[model samples]
Target chain A: MEKTGADGFDGFVTARWSALFHLARLLCGGDRHRAEDLLQEALVKLWFAWPKVADEAPEAYVRKIMGRAAARSARRRWWGERPVDRLPELAQTGDMSAAVAERSRLETALAQLTPRQRAAVVLRYYQDLSEKQVAAVLGVPVGTARSHASRGVARLRQILADVIDPVG
Target chain B: MDHFEQELARMMRDSQEYIPFASEQRERLREGVRARRRLRAATVAGGSVLLVAGLTAGLFLLPKGPAVDRPQGPLTRPGTSSSSSPAPSTSSPAVSPTQSHAPGTPTGTGTTGGSSPPSTFPSGSVDPTTFPPNPPATTATAPATSTVAQGTRTARPPVSSPPAGSHSSG
Candidate 1:
């Protein structure tokens, strides 16, 4: 229950090291360079906390820590508004282009979502967590998790609307 | 889930990329942990040395009260001359001046050699309040003296991690 020092930190590193890297990748928007830096910083924080929380799941706690860390490092907005991302046109409609467009769409859509909403989506979809599990992991109510996921998904659809239904 | 919902879920799955966590990254993390532990260990060791020195010094160096005013002590039999009990313990006080600085000034008597510089008061100087009749010295609160001495976190937490290949987090 009580983590003393090195033992707790080593246990934490063994448990969630991989998951933390993935989280950094997502939070850093596919920028593996920045993701690595962010993850190292996050791990350093976990090291600082290892003594007190050695027995707990390091991944879950670290995920919450990453949330706070990313928020702190987030690009500031102009009056609480992030400019909408301009979608790359679907030229030629080839599978390669379509895939690229879709990836961009997903990334841009995620960029549009609030940090919390993006986190909810990543935890739900990428981590394959159930709503309840996401809620518990994020330390939020299940309803709140569901709402973030729903709204995030809705916005993604809206962003893709023009690309898919060219006539509409 | 509706078709679109299912597709959206699949879309996130499709976007997922493998992140190869190199051995180097893990080493970096482990090293960071080791460094922090070392730092904490150094802090405790340093503090402990200071505490022992202070207690020893306070036992001997600072303004000790009248022999009759000697407070309770585990080191002494009750009602014995307090003078004999503390003087022996204080033999090692110089080893930890920082640790014993406050305890020396029990009740703010502020007579710690550390606090009052001999250079500040010329050899022949005497305060007007103390005139020809040197006033009887006052004692400080025992509780206050001890509190100042023990300011760091006293609670020690348990930390156990079995050797590698001995236990698993799974």
Candidate 2:
């Protein structure tokens, strides 16, 4: 039997779901629900464009959509972190707990930066993209992209000072 | 990249949890695609309706051309007086009154002849040569004269000279 468009698309989405979800989570500043929404929206778009982009770079297409949408929504409305006395999730025990705590701290710090800066930083460091690639994804100039990443990293250095100790 | 950058990258990679593509997610994606397709179809249909309606309105709103000025009756022979019939000179007294009242006769000729006093008739009638010369002048001036004279002339009856009235009333 011939492999249909839907089958191909489903397979692609299944294969890349975890990586894309993580990218979305970071893009949305670690809000799981918002990350899911973002990913779902990108997937819907990918389904429509699957015929054209399936053979080429479907993953890149989804990443571009999510990055732009995340930045645009952030600029339109303030999705500020709500301060609470107690933590939402109970602290887990053992080796994984420290990693989870570190991840939480990173997300909290990421949420503090402007949307563009956060997007640039996530694309630069987490995705390991060059400044030009980051610029292409964000639809901005290289200098602008470079500035955003540098400023974002400088801010993160202040926010995560204790978590990431200075090199001896 | 620096030590801090390396650590951040590593932490980002390590923070990702293994998430399977669930049946629930696939269903949701299918539903989302269906909804978007419906919305797009509705938008296209609405735009088409609006475009057709606008074109129809524009077609109706265009200004109409000036009304045609058609001649009211059958084309008359050129150079023949509208008031004068083809009937011979002997039948003049009998035909004159009927021709004057004919619906298609030029209003200017009827009113101009009717407004003249009965005394003016003997000179034109006695010299019969005057009658022949009058046709050309009457035909030329008939159309140029105003029809406003017709309404005023209708109030007073045409004074029929003794000779013509006697011949007709006989």
In candidate 1, what are the lDDT values of residues B98-158, reduced to their tens digit?
3333333221221222122223322222121222221212113354433332221100001
Write candidate 1's Cα lDDT for A1-168 as tens digits: 434466566555655556667566665554566667777877887767665555676666677777655544546442143646675353553556555566556666666667767777777777778999878766788999899878876776787565444331
Instruction: Give the range of the ten consecutive residues with the poorest summed lDDT in model 1 chain A.
Output: A72-81
- Native-structure RMSD, model 2: 11.0
Count of steric clashes across candidates, in order: 9, 0
lDDT string, candidate 2, A73-134, tens digits: 65554466543433355346365678788888788777777778888989998888999999
Tell how far residue A35 is off in model 2, in angstroms. 0.3
Q: Supply the DockQ value of model 1.
A: 0.16
Stretch of 10 with least lDDT, candidate 2 chain A = A82-91
lDDT of 2 by residue, B53-132 (tens): 99998777654322345446766543334564332332233323433334444233432333233233222232213234
Clashing pairs in 1: A3-A51, A4-B159, B53-B96, B54-B99, B54-B100, B56-B93, B57-B93, B106-B140, B107-B140
- What would the DockQ be for model 2? 0.72
